[model samples]
Target: MSGAMRMLAGLYRPVESQTPYGGRSVTFEAMGSAWLACGARRRSERGEGDEHHAVETMSAETRDDPRLETGRVLRFGGADWGIVTVRPLRPGRVGLELERRR
Candidate 1:
């Protein structure tokens, strides 16, 4: 697989959300990182379809030593979104939050 794909896939973590039935619910995974912008293409179009510029940087390391990055996307989700912080929780776990634009 491509380097970026491998990186993205490696970020997947098993997720088990709370259920009202007091039983295990859907078995899925959560993305270790959001605001992904490594592969975004730049454009000069001024219309609504024009792409915005993005910037990112290495954030922290997982318990398994896998590196993570904070991606920043300008003008996304109807606002400027950025991975502002990353905190290591434990081996193979991390907490990430977005930095609100002012």
Candidate 2:
């Protein structure tokens, strides 16, 4: 909530509904936007036999919002980031661990 906030990330909530065929469907509904101070990008690599997997993650700080929860979708920088974890940072701020979605 200060000048250090550089990114305006849009938050989305998952909405689940029951289908007529007794199936379930999930969709994202736009919650709102929040200013976040994104930290440095981190990358990790994993290998499983002959397969290799790369994951990109980053930390960000933003004002505490009740709708901001894990499994939510965040859209910014022309990409979608999945909320991996959320923790309270201070009285009104929360720390977020985001993973870049493929």
Q: Among these predicted structures, which one has the highest lDDT?
A: 2
- How do the residues 22-71 of candidate 1 rate in per-residue lDDT, one tens digit apiece? 87764434344433323322223232456544433233222333334455
Q: Candidate 1, after superposition: displacement of residue 94 in Å?
A: 0.5
Question: Tens digits of per-residue lDDT for model 2 on 1-102?
Answer: 344447999999888999999999999899999888988778887768998777789889988988888999899999888899999988999999999733
- Native-referenced Cα lDDT, model 2: 0.87
lDDT of 1: 0.40
**lDDT measured at residue 87 in model 2 versus the true structure, 0 to 100:** 96
List the candidate 2 regions with Cα displacement exceeding 4 Å.
1-5, 15-26
Between which residue pairs do clashes occur in model 1? 63-91, 63-92
